[model samples]
Every structure is written in C-alpha cells, then in structure tokens.
Target: MTQRTNVVVIGGGQAGLAAGYHLRRLGIEHVILDAQAAPGGAWQHTWDSLRLFSPAQYSSLPGRLMPSQEGELYPDAAHVVGYLADYEKRYELPVQRGVRVSAVHRDGAQLRVEGDADDWRARAVVSSTGTWTRPFIPAVSGRREFTGRQLHTVQYQAPAEFTGQRVVVVGGGNSGAHIAADLAHAGVDLTWVTQRPPRYLADDIDGRALFDVATARRRALEAGHTDTGGVASLGDIVAIPPVRAARDAGLLRAKPMFTRLTTTGVEWADGTRADVDAVIWCTGFRPALAPFASLRLRATWGHIATAGTRALDEPRLHLLGYGDWTGPAPATLIGVGRRPARETARQIRELLA
Candidate 1:
C-alpha cells in the first residue's frame, strides 16, 4: 500500500523545514521530500568563502535563534547547513532524503506525488522547493565552442580551486559580486559582466543592518498588498557590505551582458571581447516546476504567481520562499521563511478541517 501523508512538502530547504516544524507543532501529519541527500538547499552549493551579509538576529527560525551573537554578521554556508541539520534534529522532522519528486498531480480530492521510491498521497502540497532550483543561464551564441571551462555560480564551491586562473564572473546579482570578490582576493583574474549597472547599499544604517526592510515587507504582505512599488529590490539588498567591499577593492566592474562564447573566451554586448580561463554564470535561478506542469501555474517572469501565500488560482498549492511573495522582506535570507510557513500551516489547517 502507498504511504499517505496529510501534507507533502516538496523541498527540504529552510522554508520546507519551517513548514514541517509548524505542521508538527499543530500536530499535523506531514512528510518532507527533498531531492538532495541532505538539507540546506542552495547553501550546500554556495562558495566556501561566502558569509551572510545580513546579521544573525534576522537569521533565526520561529522558536530557535541562529546560534550566534545578536549583532554578529550572518553565518557562512557551512554554518547555515549545520544550523538546518540541527533544526531537523531538534524537531525530529520526517524528511525523506534523495527522494526526488518527479511530478505532482491531483487525484480526486488528494494530491499524488510521484518520486523515485514511491508515490505519496496528501491533502495539500507545499512547494517550498523555492525559485532557485534551476540555475538560469542566458543563451549566448557560440557557447558550445568555448574552449575554457564554464560553470554556473551554483556549481561553484571555493575560490581556492580557481587560483591563478583568469575568471569572468557573469551577471550582476549578489552571487556574481560575492564570487568575484572571493576569487579576486584569492589572486584570480576576475571580470564582472553585467548588462545593467548594479545598485549598492551600506551594511548598516544607524547601527542596524537594514533587516527592517524585509520585516516591514513581510508585514505588508500579510495585510494583503501585492506590489512592491516603493520597496528596494534584491539588487538593493546585497549592495551593502561585501558588494561595497568588492567595489572598494577594485575587484568589481560592470560590463555588458555576454553575447557570445568564443573558443578563447566571451564577447560582450558592447562588442568588447575578453580572453578568460573560466566563466562563472551567476545569473540566478528559475523555479523548477516541471514536476507540476499539469497544475495551473500563475507565473510572472517564470516564477510562481501568488497573492500573498496563496496561489493565484490553485489555492491548495502554496509557494513558499518565492521572491516578493510577502513583499520585499520575505524574499531574502532564512528568517523570511518563517512567516510564510506559519501562514501556510494555518491555511492547511483550515483546509483540512
């Protein structure tokens, strides 16, 4: 007989973990399915030198604080993974590792999740898989002909591996800035390519990291507002600290978007060509929704479209950790995942009743 769960969370990242924790608190029967062998979704693939620019106070989950001092700069990728592992252990979350969910579909009043091991039936599905599952690599001409190594920033782990090599870090996002700075410090020839100029901000405003921007946005979303016309964008979020530091160290320079990949290196949109040993595409990621294509997806720019935590049309399917889901605040850091998980758990409880 197929195993059945009251709710099935699609990803085991911070958001999914939070959802599971809340569900357990509510005494709800649920199971978390993750594609990875362990937790910490994107952090597991981040560069070794990365540290959360946001402070530790803003990085905690619902009931637990991220083990650190109040004003300490946020922990690095390894620290994040360790914290997630601890969260899982403390709550005894029932997560099935390596059970890659291939598809999710409605079966009468139940939802069917087909995985490598077996199928699962649940009353509700929380897609906490996030928007970063598939790295978005813009199509460039002659990419296949590139002689040098090329990899997405998601695949990058440490700058020590790229020492003494000329590296072109593509895209203008946080990952590009962070990776470029780390590699430059490690003595790699680094060039940052961006079609548009990047925005920057200070790490602290009046002695506090601008974490209130996120918190404020979360509150706004909970109140039923959708557009973030007045809030700062993600570019504005990562501009502080490390990005500013990268610019100060002369490690970052804005270049045109990559147009073509040549045998020697890359050609920019401005017709400038650079010969580099490797290319790090930090262009960001897309929501991996191939598994649930049959479901009506309210997508904007390839991300799931939702009004607050509820999907546009499919109310039973909720997308947690989506950028701008709860306005400006919930889109960044591990801290924002809590609000959505709590809201989603409440919604699930109401639906199940």
Candidate 2:
C-alpha cells in the first residue's frame, strides 16, 4: 500500500519543522520529508564562524524556547543545528530524511508527491522550503575563464579556509559585508564590489530597528509595489553594529556591480579588474520553485508572485518567509517566521477541513 498522510511537508528545516509541530499540536496527521540527511537546511552548510544577528529571543521555534536568554545574540551555526536536532527529538516529528521530493501533483482531492524511492499521497501539501535553496549568481561573462577559485556564499565556511588569498567579494548584501570583513581580518587581501553604495544603518537606528525597514520594504515589493528596491541600499535601513565597525575600520568599500567573471578574477561595470586568488560570490539566493514550475506562478523578476502568503491564483499554494509578507518587524528574524507559519497552518487546516 502507498504511504498516505493528512499533510506532507517538503524541506525539513525550521519552516517545515514548525509546520509539523503545529500540525501535531492540532492533531493533524502529517509527515515531513527532507532532502538532506539531517535537518537545519542551509545552516548545516553555513560558515562555521557565523553568528545570528538576531537575539536568542527571536530564534525560538513554536513550542520550545531557543536555549538562550533574552537580548543575547543568537548562537552560531552549529548551535542552531544542534537545537534543530533536539527539536526533532523533543517532538518526535515524523521526518523522513534523505528523501528528496521530485515533484508534487494534485490527483483528484489528494496531492501526490514523488520522491527518490516511492510516492506519497497527502490530503494537502505545505511547501516550507523557504527562500534559500537556489543561489543567485548574476550571469557575468568570463566567469568560467577565471582561474581563481570561485565559490558562492552558500559554499563559504570560514576565512581560515581562504587565508593568504587575495579575495574579491561580490555584492553588498549582509553576507558579502560580513564575509569581506571576516576574510580581511584573517590576513587576506579583500575587496568588496557592489553596484551601488549600500546604505549602512546601525543595528538599532534612532530606536527603530534596521530590520523593520527591510521587512517593510520587502512587504511593499511583495504587494506589487516597490520601496527603493528591497533594502539593498543600506542608507534606507539601520546598520548592524558589526557592519558599522567594519565601515569604521575602512575594510568595506562599495565597488561597481558584477559585470563578468574572468579566470584570474572578476571584472566590474566600471572596467576595473581585480586579480583575486578567490572569488566569493555573496550575491544572495532565489526561491527554488523548479519542482512546482508546472503550476502557474505569479512572479516578478524570479521570485514567486503572491499577495502576502497566498498565491495570486492558487490560494492553496502558500509561500512563507518571503521578503516582506509580515511587514517590517516580522520578516527579518526567525521570530517573525512563527506568525506566518501559524497563519498558514490555520489556513491549511481550514482547507483540509
């Protein structure tokens, strides 16, 4: 007999885990299917030295508190992964690891999910894969010609691994700023290249959180409106303390946007070239919706198109963790994620009923 569930959650990271936790609490029968051998999706592969900018209070899952105190800076990647593992144990969430979902299709009133081994039938499907699956590297010419080691931020682990190398970090986002600073401190010659000078804000600016601006901008864009284009320019949002410190140290410089990749290094739009030993593309990520390509997508640029979490056409297919669905306060931290998950779960429950 084919395995069946009330709901099937794809991607067993924080989002999927949260969905499972809520479903169980509501007495909804569900199973979580994760691609990786373990939980903590991108965190499992994040750089070792990285720490959460959000405090511990903002990082907790639905029922359990993140094992830290209020106002304390959240733990590193390892700590987060450990916490996720513990969450799975605590809830005994029925997650099937190592099972990659190939596709999800609707069959009559049920959803059919094909995986590496077998197919699953569920009354409904919650795609909690989140936004970090596909890394966005702009199509720059001569990237393949670059002789230097080129890697995405998703692959970056630590500066110790790139010590003694001349590194060119591309993009001006949070990841790029952090990586450039870290590697430069580790005795590596570093240059950060961004198309536009980012507007840096203090982590707390004028008693208004920087993330609040980001969350607001994201929500605006998601609503088919644009607010100076999604927090790319730091001047619009508050800067984190570390970013301010980096700026004060003169370690961060805004360069032209990426133009092309050469074997020796990267070339910028201004025709400037850097012969880098390593190229760290801290560009950012795109949602992985390839599995659902058959479904009509409401999109702008490459991101999914939805009015808030509800799909424009298909209300059953909801998207969470989008750039601005929760307005300014809830979009930037894990804490904000809970509200959306709760709302989405409620909607899913209603749909199933």
Best by TM-score: 1
lDDT of 2 by residue, 1-353 (tens): 36898888887888777778878887888888888997776689888667776666556778887787344464678788888899888999999999888777767778788888978998777776766768888778887787878889988988888777788888776788878777766768888878677656555552134455565666566677857544445453234565566778877777777688777777767787777798888888877767666665667776676655656656666665545542233333353445666776787789888
Q: Candidate 1, which segments miss by more than 4 Å at Cα?
A: 69-72, 205-211, 215-242, 269-271, 326-328, 331-334
Give the whole-model CA lDDT for all candidates, comma-separated. 0.76, 0.72
Candidate number of the best lDDT: 1
Q: What tens digits encode model 1's per-residue C-alpha lDDT throughout 101-125?
A: 8888889899888998899999999
lDDT of 2 at 256: 73
Candidate 2 TM-score, C-alpha based:
0.86
C-alpha-based local distance difference test score of model 2: 0.72
> Tell me, what's the RMSD of every candidate?
2.9, 3.5
Task: Give residue 41's lDDT in candidate 2 (0 to 100).
Answer: 69
Pairs of residues at least 3 apart in sequence or in different chains that clash in candidate 1: 214-329
* Residue 344, candidate 2: alpha-carbon lDDT: 68
